[model samples]
Target: MSKPSGKSMDEIVALCRRRGFIFQSSEIYGGINGFWDYGPLGTELKRNLKNAWWEDVVLREMVGPDGKTIEMVGLDSTIIMHPKVWEASGHVAGFNDPMVGCKTEGCKRLFRADKVFMVDLGLDPSGKHVDVGVEADSKAKAEELAIGIAKRFKIRHDANPNPIAFSVLEEFAEIPTDMQRFPCPNCQHRTLTPPRPFNLMFESHSGPIQSDDNKVYLRPETAQGIFVNFLNVVNTTRVGVPFGIAQQGKAFRNEVTPRNFTFRSREFEQMEIEFFIHPSTAKEWYAFWRDNRFAWWQSVGLTSANLQLREHEKDELAHYAKEGAGTSDIEYRFPFTAPGFGELEGVAHRSDYDLRQHAEHSGLRDKMKYFDQERNEKYFPHVIEPSAGADRGTLALICEAYTPDPSRPSGVYMKFHPRMAPVKAAVFPLVNKEGMPEVAEKLYRELRKKWVVDYDPKQSIGKRYARMDEAGTPYCLTIDGQTLKDNTVTVRYRDTLQQERIGIDRVGEFLGQKIGSAQV
Candidate 1:
């Protein structure tokens, strides 16, 4: 299962476009910057990951020794909520990226220096390598130097001879500057600006009236929705303090710079859980959630070697959390892709900050309550939030599944686990004629109900299998002359290329057992 070497970030992006995994959004009009559209194969893979996450965290009903499973529930909420909510959540004033603008001659482009470095290195700008605290007093000088280097490397444009090189305009264009600005972490120049807040939330008008009172924001994270709706569900269901409300939904952030394909898009899906616990037990529950989430990722086929656990230092802890722990470093395969561990998931023990915020802002203090068996023990329940980026999870699965079988000439085959593969089993006809197509089509229809199946009769059997392999189909079923003779078909495994003759009538049962409720 060796990975393909010497592949650059551009090469992977081109391959994704060629193989129908992803496409630049609105390409006809030169495409929108920082946006992407998932193609058939990519969409399937993303969907499978989402479904798998729901099954693992939401519906599992996992129980611990403390009998806390009874308090968990799943919830869905709106993307936009009351404008005051963001204000109370600290997003209105504190959510922001430190952006440094290049005030150079004929070039004022705001360079997310962090992103610029990543782009140069073919890396993901996931806050691993770029530092934004650099004092850019010589902004003009830095822009000149950077533009000259970009030209020398000829890295500004796609390799289409369109000369998309970095150009200067009298008016500086605003680019995302989300990197850490050290007086110069890279050069150690020691001139640093005090960190300031850059709100990432997208604000909008809630009603036709464009007034200050109507200002609302698209949620920056899905966890807030669950938090806001906490009392409603708890009071209605009469659930206890240890219960949780899990959610999977879209959140919008005005990311200073959206790069690394869809990894840090302005809009993305999040799988989050707000586990309520006694204030006294918040730290323990935080640790518990952290371990559980880390284990879940490993169970889903992300190799343990490629992941790490990073604990947030005291100073780095968020304003609300008493403590927090992060997942270990993730090694992705893009250039400039940072080598350090970033937080893939985090479990933060927030001591009722959210509940207090909502209560004070909305004057609903009495509505939210918790009564424990400690008779007189009564207070707002603390929360341990386990949150992860859905896109990152999918990318990790792809990275883990990415394999190049030495036996195959095509170089690489994504060896996705049975549950994660986009297509579980590709149904193909041995040939385009002799009623084989009819049989394959019938089989495809039947299997499509139970699996994400594909039927391809245009290519030879070997070629078809290769195509499926690239798409990460776990198995391929072929209908040949032997099938008409014995009511049997060849079930070929993608990774091993081993074929087995199995009765056609029993195909579903065989696959169900083989894939049986695996975590993937």
Candidate 2:
């Protein structure tokens, strides 16, 4: 299927508001940056997205090698864990974004250094297009990307020398600079200060003691919690190597700047899985999870053309994705993201770094090893993590599903897969009278018990169907005089606009068959 052209963030935000999908958090108090609240429709879609993920990753067993199947277990860990846990996982020190603040008076907004460089180059603030160093560590690679961007954008040291754009960009890439300054992208003034490290974790005090000694942190990623409980899960579930622990929960990040609506929120939900496997099989399992996740997104209705796998360059691999553990991202063509694409999820081979970290830090190294009865080997299982943002996933779906139908004036409808649609179907009485309402109401009530159904009796059947279409309802059932005569009704499919007549008694069966288990 051909993918729809990019939809502006403004247009999407407007639709979300008009349709009650999402809203600004605390909007009455001028709203909060990097925070948002999902409305009725948005909440339903997000919930359904996570539920679908759980069903696929944990509940449903998948065929494995030699026709064997792997069944995953689910996990729900606490949001705030031990402070030492952060120290072990590396979030306490390294989970940061280089921040460069505008030094110009009256404008002191901090910008992520790479994003600033992107804007300086007359492009989207996402740096997905400019590949600086694939094999370099984060800071060094950022610096390299800055230099390449400087040269490409022709940010001449002589022409815009005083702009200090290149200098500021380079400095921020490596370290927060207190020495050099640059022009502010927003103010166009030379009020940019040297970059500084801003830790993303949200820290809090424990036991009413506001001191570092009593500090705890809201998790920035869901992976650590799973790692921390690896032993517990094994002991309790009797699951061994090659199993997964899937979780969906809220994570917090003190983002430098939250732009593009809910794409970069400070508080967001994540659906992640930490799949454990024998160390020797890390790469193989990595590829398996990578392709599996990519295919799963397509199965849920994202277009294949708009989705691509981006291998992490050797230089830019994650600190943990080392020594045979590889990493890659599934990128989607989000209109506002840089170069027209952004990461929807990441699949990483973490090389047992996390488990090793926890073992060493918690002083349980010897006891932390997993005993594989099948192989008679005791070892720390390497991990392949597939982590995605629930909110971002929904946004990607919304962007992909927003289709324009030229058959109607000002026509646009969400072409969601029935599985992801918030409202699955709508029931409309052909008219307000002639016993049609009686039959429609009965069908509506019955379908409501089975699906997220809606009933429309006020407007003409045509308008009602249109409204349901905009809401992404997959099927609309209309009851007219035919239903009173032969107990058959018209069923209109959303994407095709094709109609089929079936017995009223068989509507449930027809929908169940069309929707299928996953679609339902």
Name the candidate that leads on TM-score: 2
lDDT of 1 by residue, 46-123 (tens): 888788778877777687537646457789899998777777888776665444444334434453333222122221
Candidate 2's displacement at residue 360, Å, is: 0.9
- Clash counts for all predictions: 30, 12
Model 2 agreement with the true structure over 1-520: per-residue lDDT tens digits: 2224645666777888988999999999999889999999988898888888988888776875425687588889999999899999988877665667776678777676555642223332442322221112344444455545556544443332222123344544555453233445555455566666778899898887688789889999888989999999999987878888999999999876788888889999999999899987876788888888888888788864777788888777877886666788988887676356788899988888999999999999979999999999999998899999888899988888887686953377888988889998888899989999999999999988988888888976778877876788899999988889999999898888899999999989987886664521
Question: What is the C-alpha local distance difference test score of candidate 2?
Answer: 0.78
Least lDDT summed over 10 consecutive residues: which range in candidate 2? 127-136
lDDT of each: 0.68, 0.78
**Best-fitting candidate, measured by lDDT?**
2
Write down the TM-score of every candidate.
0.78, 0.83
Evaluated at residue 313, the lDDT of candidate 2 is 87
